[model samples]
Target: MNKSRFWVVGGEYTSTDFETLIQGTERVVGPFETRGDAERTWRVLSEDHRPQAQVRFTIAHEHLTMNA
Candidate 1:
């Protein structure tokens, strides 16, 4: 079976603060081999936390195509 995983990390404070931010989101998908890998993935998706900002949310997506 094929599976997908997602990790999100965001905080206006510091990287460590992202841990608390994760608690309010969906449960993290597993099969993560190492904490460093997981952290790296999360950092990629993380955004700055701005509660009072006019634009409170942001979304980003990317597609990669490779030739064999």
Candidate 2:
């Protein structure tokens, strides 16, 4: 069996191009059960960091194997 998980990943980047993230600025929000939950959190984080043009965040989805 398998289960889907969601996460919010990102933080301050080194530049506007967003090729690299600044040291110690990387952030991982979590393994949310649903995309909606992750999106809500993403919205808040994005809004809070809206003033920083170099800061960005996005939702990442992963599939995990579940053992019975």
Candidate 3:
């Protein structure tokens, strides 16, 4: 059997330092099954935290697990 493992990654950066960073340092929430799931989490974080840096969420990577 093959299992799909997806991950979500986030990072923070402000306009003053936009060139230095592309994403947020904070991991909002992850390991969800689908993009929608990650998006939902990102939404919550966006609403809950109003940090000096902007938050960005993306599907970082996917891992394939094989089971015998």
Candidate 4:
């Protein structure tokens, strides 16, 4: 079965919380089932990226689950 999932990737911006797509320092994380899921994940990422004023998060659907 296809186990591909979506992901959330963005950059660290100390300006505003907006859509930066593929800009600034690159950061990728996730294999979420839905965009909303990824967005939730982004929150954690944003917090981890603290010290910055603004942060951007994006959803990317192109990851496959690995089975062992």
Number of the predicted model whose TM-score against the real structure is largest: 2
lDDT of 1: 0.38
- Candidate 1 stretches greater than 4 Å from native: 1-27, 48-68
Off by over 4 Å in 4: 1-4, 13-24, 61-68
- The C-alpha lDDT values of all candidates are 0.38, 0.97, 0.61, 0.71
10-60: candidate 3 lDDT, tens digit per residue: 566555444444543657466888767767776776666556445555565
Candidate 1, poorest ten consecutive residues by summed lDDT? 52-61
Model 2: how far is 13 from its true place, Å? 0.7
Q: Which should have the higher lDDT, number 1 or number 3?
A: 3
Predicted structure 3: clash tally? 5
lDDT of 1 by residue, 1-68 (tens): 33333333233322333333333443343335455666665544443333422212222222335555
Candidate 2 ranges with C-alpha deviation above 4 Å? none
Clashing pairs in 2: none
In candidate 4, what are the lDDT values of residues 1-68, reduced to their tens digit? 35667787778664574545336588878678777888788778877777765656667787565766
**Stronger candidate by TM-score (1 vs 3):** 3
- Candidate 3's displacement at residue 9, Å, is 1.4
TM per model? 0.29, 0.93, 0.52, 0.47
lDDT of 2 by residue, 1-68 (tens): 99999999999999999999999999999989999999999999999999999999999999999999
Model with the higher lDDT, candidate 2 or 3: 2
Using TM-score as the measure, what is the rank order of every candidate, best first? 2, 3, 4, 1
